[model samples]
Target chain A: MNTRYIFGIIITVVLLSVNQAFIQYWLAQKKHDANTINIAGKQRMLSQRINAEFYRLEKESASPHLLKKLVAEWKTSHFKLQSKDKSNKLVPITNSEIRLALKELNPNIEFIESQLNNIGKASLNLSLINQNQNSFLPKMDKIVKSLEKISDKKLQFIIKTEFFLFFMSLIILILEVVFIYIPIEKSLNLANAEISKKNEDLKQALTSIGKKNRELEQITYITSHDLQEPVRTINSLVNIFKIKYARDFDEEGIKMLRYLDTATVRMRDLIKDLLDYSIIGKKREKTKIDCAEILEIISKDLALKINETKAKITWGRLPKILGIEAEIRLLFQNLISNALKFQMKGHQPKIDIAAIEKKDFWLFTVSDNGIGIESKNVEKIFSIFHRIHSKDKFEGTGIGLAHCAKVVDIHGGAIWVESELGKGCTFFFTIKKDQNKIVGYEQQTELYITS
Target chain B: MNNKLNSILLVDDDEATNFIHQFVIQDHGACKHIVTKLDGQEAFDYLTTPNESGLPSPDIIFVDINMPKLDGWGFLEKYESEFGSNSSKIIVMLTTSLNKYDKERAESMNVISEFRNKPLSPEILDEIVEKYFTNKHMVQ
Candidate 1:
């Protein structure tokens, strides 16, 4: 959009500059034409003055010296009339009638000059001189008339040229407005309408998605609450039956009862894990949390597991970040527990936890020397109920890593793992330092709601 | 161990949960008497009305959150406003809800003494009796 405006402005400036240059050139040409016309008019006036001097010489008794002075003045005016300089280059006139008239006037000027010279040379008959001067009078009048006609024609030509230029400039301006400015404005309006429409559609989609998400959360809460009642009943009733009737039951019956007890207990644990996974960030209390403190709490919680696995856990200096204290604690707890639980046979687990500050966030890594996951199962491990090992081998409802992912996601971060089979695995995650700043998909939903 | 109280009250909408809870309490022998109410309203009625035999009020009341007529929160509101300030009866909220909001609400109310998940086991019942009832004598 900005580029379009800039391009339009550049084109308009160039066109206006070209039009101004043309107008200036035409105005200069008109000024030159006026100069030429003024010179021609001066020449005609000089011829009339010379004629008057000749009449004055004939009528009044003048001394030979005065006649010589008048003749010299006439010669000077005649020479000036046809004087040529750098700017005054004589060219043939364009109009044929004006050219022809000027041709007649030139010879007459020559004839008059010769007559004056003859009178100056001898004090001859006065009547004959006077007759020649009378003839010069008519020729001077004719030359003046022709010069006036040429000046009028030049004035008319200049006015016509200016009018034509004015009309052409107006046409160009109108064409530019019609073809360029108006179309561009119309398309801009159309594009704006389209963008607003798309924005409205996006808003509607986000609102509906938020509504569906809310409904799903409600259903999950209700389902988990209601389902636990029966499971708990089954568990209690099973326990009561074993306590009351264990002596009468056979060996096979005892094994079946124990299986029932195990199934009920596992079901209960599954339900509990599911509930925990669903409520990860439901009640977030954001504040400045010290990562070192949270890690200490997690280590204490896993003291027994750490002892059983003989895990040599080490950590670097952790930074204080703005986040939900409980969620961050849970995130560390899960990773540490997983590291302790997935150790190779006869291998003491070596777990390293550290945080490195990046440009806008902190990158945390929990690396473990454990029975590493296969490349293909790295992504699958984080999904709910995607267990890579059988329950007999590794007991889990497969919701721990999923819960960790949720915690990372709610904080506007990403979590992933880099692992090779039979070697070690490193789980990396990022947390933005600014917890109050909303980011990513959550920000979009927030905008939709507020708007 | 000697029975900790004269009577106990259980408030829950589900009969099966109440049954299991009653069995757990009976097995633990924490109280001499146990009364079961289907919902919060029934439990409230049982508490407000006087018995012809002149029995003492239950030492502990266990109420569930989600019910048809009246919920645990509604019961707590009523109980606190009416017979709350001087009564020595302990109120323990019991529910299958894993929602943090419910737990937080329970924690904020001064009348509520404990929040426990269902269905109650003998060990949990014994712990509650030992902490609230047995500790009362020690404090005195």
Candidate 2:
């Protein structure tokens, strides 16, 4: 719970407990007050009975022992009215009216007791005894009435306090419901609604992005495929025209035709490269690709080139990676061909390929003794159509490295080059071990974007 | 070099491509009679119908892979069901698609003689004719 809620609960519990304790104390005091009132009322009856017994001794010959017993009982009852308990110690009386009534009765009770002490003696004063008894009875009666009034007042106070405590507890409960509980519930509901709305929005955005990606892929494939036919036709017609009408064309016209043929050929290559680039990641299947075997195939394919250049291509033992075989083959083809193509003049190309196992992926390096790239242009080489050298020097559609980058990216890896001018270059790329877990382009895009 | 074919059929969706192939085949002296169709559907109809001369089917059929109506794969399936490998016609799968699956599929089919890329050249045409028709010409 939050700090505020915890504090609220603690305070509510403390207040209710304190109120309950006060009610309990007051109820115990109510019982003590009832006992004090009962003793005070009994003192009044004792005083009257003692006076009547004294009158019987004086006129109708009552027993002195009964009178003495009545006197003793009267004293004990009177003491108990003001005392704390049977110990007969005077309690601190809080009600001044009952205290004054008991104080006035004390002297009359003492005088009657003194007259009764000489009951069987000749020194007994009957008249004095009658007078003191008469005064003590009314005084004790006044004390009894005052005690009842105080008890009644105390009982009423206890009842009123109990009702107040109940009302306050109800108010606290209502306040907590209105201020704390209801608002917490409402905010919880609002937060839930907002979260669901955001989820819905994200879902819609993802579907739309998927749809747009599919549409763009279709457009790219269709446009490149359809454009190839016209370019091929142009190339073929130009060849036919040169053969059929060579006598009519001058030197300049022939040269112009040659330029047209070169342009058409370049356009065709660019379209083919674009189509190839767009087709990457279209098929999302991962299988065990033996890099060593793929290297063997590439070696066989480039055997003539290797012989012609007398280039020595060597590789360490390679590992099998989980990836699309075609994509991985294309990646290796581009990197190795690039290494061979950028060789220095009169220098035998020395290519070394090796794979190092990392924590989560295999890092492969293709190092070549070739005319390496400049440091500034290394990053730009992976972009589509971004060529560092002029078309006259390097013959390429400039899509090879871009294709390599896309393949590595879709396999959940990274590709980069470390090179210097006029020296050898090393192209490093990684293939994730868990390539089968890669779902598709959408997930791959999210992965790279986050990384 | 007496390895010229009697006839050749070009099945493709693009009219320009068909024209270029026709021009190239004629210029190479590979065939005297050349026939072209827009898609696999027209090629199927032509192969099934009886001609006026009642000559046998063309010696070679160059079929493009990607087409609007009834693609090369569809035509191949229909042709195998209809002819059942008894026919002597040579079928070449010709297309611009560099997809490896298409080449593999063509390689797996017994009816297909060869799979070649588009923009057929004179050198490639000569090689095909030499490889398949030269021995036949000697036997004849």
Candidate 3:
């Protein structure tokens, strides 16, 4: 995977973890808050009930039956308070489980209620205790005192449960902030670092390209202006020799003169080709290109050679792409001409063309059943002026493949040849899909200028 | 039309180029004397030799721009400052380059009569012969 994608994934995971932690912390806080409110509310209700019971006791002192009923009511209320509180009090660990445990205390609450009823029955025998008023008062006070004990116990339980919940919630919040949120920040910083490194690499590449551009400019100037002088000298000398020495020359000298003239013409053609190679595709431009049309154009351009060699060219499906059209055409022209040039002795010249699409890229193959190259010279073929065959054997500038390589490189692609001697040769190259939808195919780069 | 201009000088580094030019001058059958040098040094030395009698100094010197040791530009430098301006010789820049820089350098020297590209043709020789050898009549 690309480094950027990896960094993106890490940042995403960190953010998700942070989000999950925040949600969990919020839920924990909500649970703790609800429990505290429930506990406090339960305590307040029990306190209010006890206050009412005490006031009622002070008002009704003469009626034993009424006093007995009031005592029974207070006992029942106290038991209910203890039972409800045991269930609802701040369950620090698990409030729902505590609620279930409080159900188990129901029977205990009922037993306490029974004890209250008995207390009511005993209070009705106040005639025996009224002989000592203080004794009867103390008797009623004991019944009330038992109710207060239960209420106080429930209040203390709720206070402890609520305190524990608050502490646990604080711990969960701190853990979430430190472990989840902090790592997210760190991941983002790492992504920033990766981006910065890529940026620096890009800057260095551009600087190097700038230096290369200057060198290329100098080479172009020297080649166009300096090397040309010698060829012109040779041309003018040829003209002079023909004018001055034609009368003295024999048939051999005349033949030599023709060879000299032909050689000079060939040199001129080679120099022009080299100049085109370096100059074309230097400033890469994107444009819509139809491969079939470009091929037709090249065929038309090389019609004379094709007719001379009686070469048969066949093309497979060629998908149109966005590229520099002229350079692409030159690439095809060179490869096709090379195929035509290196033909088997007596076999009919035949070339096979094929292409396939692979995920936003196109692979093109130009194969010929001509003279195949050795494996060792595969890499050497693309180098400037490198020729497997000598000039005497074949007529070539030895720059066609070099020009094609340059053109493919400008498209952010690569061109390579696979071949075995006497078998055949196939040229492969890849062209990327240009999204900007431009159709610029200008070809005027000057890559080579020979003497 | 007989004038005091009877001699001509040719300066170039390449012996073959000088030989060809000398052949062309002889073929044209004009100037009484044609002094050839391998570089600008010999040409400058021959020019600065003080002459008491006004036997015409090389009436015109054709200097090739590219040379070893003393180039045409260097010869021009000595010709002006070391030798006085009132001399009889006229200088012409002969080079293989038609580059603007070479032309500009020649013009700035102030000693040059004209700039010409090399592999001098019969036409160029004729022009030179007519310009300096006033005594020579046109070939019929």
Q: Which candidate is the best by TM-score?
A: 1
Q: Could you tell me which 10 consecutive residues in candidate 2 chain A have the lowest summed lDDT?
A: A442-451
Pick by DockQ: 1 or 3, better one = 1
**What is the clash count of model 2?**
0
For every candidate, C-alpha RMSD to the true structure in Å = 8.7, 10.9, 12.4
Better of 1 and 2 by lDDT: 2
TM-score of chain A of 3: 0.52
Query: Least lDDT summed over 10 consecutive residues: which range in candidate 1 chain A?
Result: A442-451
**TM for chain B in all models?**
0.91, 0.94, 0.79
**Each candidate's DockQ score against the native complex?**
0.25, 0.26, 0.07
Which digits, one per residue and each the tens of the lDDT, describe model 1 over residues A1-451? 5665566677667767876886786566556556555656565455556556666766674654655555565555444444444344432346566556555555555666567667758555545545655664565456456655766675687678667867776776677677777888899899999999999999899888977876676567556655667887888889988987988999999999999999999998888777677666766678889998888888888999888878898998999998878888999998988888887766899999999999889999999989999999999999987799989988888889999998998887899999999888999999987776754334321111000
> What fraction of the true interface contacts does model 1 reproduce?
0.35
Q: Which should have the higher lDDT, number 1 or number 3?
A: 1
- List the lowest-lDDT window of 10 residues for candidate 3 chain A: A127-136
**Clashes (candidate 3):** 17
TM-score of chain B of 3: 0.79
